[model samples]
Target: MDYHNPNYATSLYHFIPSPLFLGKQIAPNAFQTTPKLHILDLSGNAGCLPEHPELSSMPELQELYLRRMQISVFPAEIMSLKQLRTLDLSQNSLQHIPQGVKDMTSLTQLDLSDNNISALPPELGMLEPSLQVLKLDGNPLRSIRRTILDRGTKAILKYLKERVAED
Candidate 1:
């Protein structure tokens, strides 16, 4: 319907750094009004905000874009979105690939490119059955050779699964 109505706001494209709005701009209870929200873009809001606890409230979200948000800690709360299909956390300061990611069973595409990530969790193998795309380019992965990553999704996933079986 109308964008002004909180119930109708299904998508929000906020380029302004979220730190400026934390606690001051958004009322703590405001997120409850939009239960249908599916897409959220807060890309480029880097450094100022480290952890966003508010995202957990939006369980209906499907596509979440947080590129360059500088979130070092994965918000396990965001994993509450069982409907999530695409998650873009590229170009941030993340180092570890969080375990909670395996719970997003509906995910088809996940982007974690261009970060400081040095290794990956074998639990990533669990996503192979449903995950259609996973972008891990630009990370300094040590365990898996760059040659395997260049071979693409099937190769990378198979390599991770093999590692899991060996462990």
Candidate 2:
């Protein structure tokens, strides 16, 4: 795909299939030309993203799907997107949620399921104001009990908030 074309300059959505890159790192310049993207789905591309993807170029991005990307660490670059409402990082290799997640104040939905996460950051509780949907299923969480996890997002947020208050 010719990313530099004028037609794609104002495009608000883009989906790059995994087969196209064959697990190779996506070029840093791939999304540099499309700054207005609101929704970008680069799912199923294992290790296609660098540790810190150059997503700062898309300030208007609202929903980003990076499922099954084999990412072990949280992509700190996403913290710059204050307009982001939904972020899907499920099915990755993430081991923990970072404190920087509190910076994503606009996120209403966050998916971290099917990962190796063992605990939820207390800072995540701060997002309770805007975050409505939090998926932690298929994880091996030890910090939060099963009851809270089963009670759903609200309960999980409450638990985390209490933990934050304790510290």
Candidate 3:
């Protein structure tokens, strides 16, 4: 799909399937014109994404799904989405969640399962009040014990919060 197509300027939701961006890097301003976009799903697209996708322009974006995008590093640009509620980056190649994630105050759900993350940043605990769901299954987590992870989101958040307090 041609991202520059003016026909998608006011689109609220945009989805691009696999092979469309295969092994290609998404342009930094690919979505710059879609200011009204609320949901963007680029799942199954095995490609390299820019360090910061041009998502800051879409202030109303609530849910973003980049599952199976072959991402290794967390995109810092996503932190600028103040109104985002759900973010799914599952089935990627992420190794760590950046401390900057705390800036996403409106996130209610975050799915980082099936990644390579071995440790989670304590800053994640800051979102306990607003974050209702966090999925970390399928990762090689060493910072958190299996029992805590098995206890579900509440227990996981509590454990992370305790770690933050310790610091």
**Model 1 lDDT tens row, 1-167:** 47677545445432233455543334445555556677766676554333445666677778888787777766676788888889899988788988667778899898989988898888787788788899988988898988998898878878887887898
Candidate 1 clashing pairs? none
- Report clash pairs, candidate 3: none
Encode model 2's per-residue lDDT on 64-113: one tens digit a residue: 99898778888888999988999999998999788989889999999999
Q: Worst 10-residue stretch by lDDT in candidate 3?
A: 12-21
Q: Assess candidate 2 and give its TM-score to the true structure.
A: 0.90
Model 3 TM-score is: 0.88
Q: Name the better of 2 and 3 by TM-score.
A: 2
Candidate 2 stretches with Cα past 4 Å from truth are 1-4, 10-12
Off by over 4 Å in 1: 1-30, 47-52
Task: List the candidates ranked by lDDT, beginning with the highest.
Answer: 3, 2, 1
For model 3, residues 1-167, the per-residue Cα lDDT tens digits are: 56577775666465554665567777888777778777888787666567777888888899999899889989888999998999999999999899989879999999999999999998898888899999998999999999989998888888888888999
TM-score versus the correct structure, for each prediction: 0.81, 0.90, 0.88
Off by over 4 Å in 3: 1-8, 16-25
- Looking at model 1, which ten-residue stretch has the lowest summed lDDT? 9-18
lDDT of 3 at 89: 97
lDDT for model 2: 0.86
In angstroms, give how far residue 41 of model 3 lies from its true place: 0.2
